[model samples]
Target chain A: MIDHIDSKIIALLGKDARMPNNKIAKAINVSEGTVRNRIAKLLKKNIINISLIRNVNQMDNPGIAFVGLDVEASLKDKIAMQLSKMPEVRFVSSLMGRHDLMAFVLADNATELSHILYQKIASLEGVQFTESSIGLKYFKYDYKWGRLLSEAK
Target chain B: MKNNLDNLDIQILDLLEEDGRASAKSIALKLGITEVTASKRISKIIKGDHCKVVAIADFEKCGFEFLLPMGIRVHGKQLEQVAEKISSLDAVYSVSAVSGIQDLEILCATKTLDETVELLDVTLPAIKGIKSITPAISSKVYKFQTDWAPLGND
Candidate 1:
């Protein structure tokens, strides 16, 4: 269980993942060794993933697409796994709605994004219908785990 | 290199991705550069908004039992307004304007199925210009991360 101390440590890293443990220890009023131990445990449990979140509009992945896929009901799980293997496909999820699977795709541009949808995704087996949504604006992209880490445990 | 971030920046990002709290001294040693150089580069990368590092709490452990990738198809010209409203809700971690079936996409999580239902049925219906709402819960997520690479490895 993530007690209040763990919550504070996680919150500090959420602010700046590269923040030194010593700084975090001082801020959270915990020993640096305690912070270190807790982090190790959290990582072991797969409770927290410390990774880089690049800003949008780079040369390679200048375009982002939200592809809503309606796949063969029986093959939803199977197809989702296949989609995950694609390099351009960033995130894959089996969803319940007009679409059976949700794929967050990355490409160089609009044309490339479209190509991925038509050539790559559309051609895949069990991908019955695909509706591609090019991501326009990201009003909110909070990776801070706000509610969970901010308030009291 | 891609965008304003170069190969070295990507390497640093990758090293840090492996260990978010990796020290500049350690990164410098790995990259075969001066510690000052590594720290300076990291500072610049952050200052330029090339990337950010954050703690991604465990959703299940955090008590977010139901994770819904909910889409709201709202009436014309109301997309931004409705999106702004949704962004205010704490459960929502992501809100983006996307093309296709849904005008707005939101990744919102709640502790219980009832709360999620309330978000779709009760809360959203109260909002104006909502034509339809589509909600999908992910049973399995194969890949979910935010990272870019210079050689197109990400």
Candidate 2:
């Protein structure tokens, strides 16, 4: 579990991952060494990952699609595993509702996205059928996980 | 503005994507450029709004146990209003106007089953323009890449 200090550090980093350690220390009222040590610990524990995320809207010809898949009950996990291995697949999750599995795919255009959904995803063993939704506009795609940590028990 | 990122910008992005905390000096050394040049390029990339370097916390570790993906059908021409309203919710991580059966797709993170149920049963339904909602709970997440694919291979 993380303390308030750690949470503050994370909050700052969530805003700008490359924020200087001394600046974060000054903002959070902690020593630079303390900030550095905490971040190192957090990264080592796999509790937080600092990385760069592109704004998908700014890209050209990027097609984003979410696919809901119906698969044989016994092969649900297997099918999810297969989908996870595909480069086009960004997120794959096994579900318990209308769809047994769901995958988020990204491609260059509608044609590429169609090829992925029809030619690749649908051909996977045990994939009964696939329902797809193409993303038109994204109003919010916030990856900052700091605020959520405040509510964590 | 659309990203007019050249080869050098792309390379810097790739390095930062691999290690967001990589120092300008280290990046300069690795890419065979001056530290000042590397620092300026980093600023240009970020100031241009091309991408953001941020820390992503693991949901489970942070006590968010549920990942709820909801398909929402809007009640008429209120798609924009409803999408914007839902986007402001604290639990919602993403809100997208989508094509196909559902008018919008939302991905939410919650701390417990009760919170998940409350979000689906009460909070969302209370919204005026939401026609209907189809919600699913993720049993196991195989992969969730925060990085957009167009920036890198695959």
Candidate 3:
């Protein structure tokens, strides 16, 4: 369970992951040791991750597509596992709705996107049909999950 | 926007991707470069707006039990307007304009089934010019890689 201090620390880190412990301590009015220990605890619990994320908009000719799959009921989980293993598949999730599974694929260009959608994913045994949406522009990709941390029980 | 990054920049990014807190001195030693160069490159990458070094919370662990991917078909010229509105919602993590049947795709995080239903049934429909919505709840998330550029380049 995350307390007030933990949420405060998380909010600061969400803005600048590289902010020094001393700086965070100053900002949050906590000791450097406290902040350090809290961050360590958070990491150990897999509650948060501190890492570098590339801005997709900065890349040249980057192709990002979301492919929704209708699959054989019995093979949904098996097929999702296979999609997860593909290098180009960045996000694979088993869904409950019109599509049994949804996979987000990232590639170099449109040609590669087509290949992944048609040749690779479509050929999977359980995939009955696929509907893909190529992301033309990214309006927002906010990773500041800190504000919502307070809502966590 | 095209990346003007050289080999060294990519290497530094790769190291940072593994550990965002990896010190400039440690990165320099690992890549056989001067500490000043590593530090400068790190500043350049970040200050230049190439990428961000940030903490990403796993939604499930952070009390968000539902990850809903909703596809919205907008009414004619309201695509941009609708996308902007959806992006403003606190629950929305991402909103992107796409090609094909849907005009916009959004990934939303909610805490319960009731909230998920409210979002799909009540909240979204209340917004004007939304032609239709197709919603899906992710039962399990297998992979969600944040470092796409480095991984794709390699």
What C-alpha lDDT values do all the predictions have?
0.76, 0.84, 0.82
Expressed as tens digits, the lDDT of each residue in A1-153 for candidate 2 is 788998999888888889999999999999999999999998887788886878776666788998999998999888987887888888888887858998899887889999999999999889998889999888787677522222111
Question: Higher-lDDT candidate among 2 and 3?
Answer: 2
Ranking by TM-score: 2, 3, 1
Query: Which structure is stronger by DockQ: 2 or 3?
Result: 2
RMSD in Å for model 3:
4.7
| DockQ pick, better of 1 and 2 | 2
Global Cα lDDT for candidate 1:
0.76
TM-score per model over all chains: 0.87, 0.92, 0.91
Q: What is the TM-score of chain A alone in each candidate?
A: 0.86, 0.90, 0.90
Which ten-residue region of model 1 chain A has the weakest summed lDDT? A144-153
Retained native contacts per candidate, as fractions?
Answer: 0.71, 0.75, 0.74
Which candidate has the top score in DockQ? Answer: 2
lDDT of 1 by residue, A82-146 (tens): 88778888778777565788888888787888788899899888888888787887778776652
* CAPRI quality level assigned to candidate 3 from its DockQ score: medium
- Candidate 3, residue A81: Cα displacement in angstroms equals 1.0
List where candidate 2 sits over 4 angstroms from the true fold.
Answer: A145-153, B1-3, B149-154
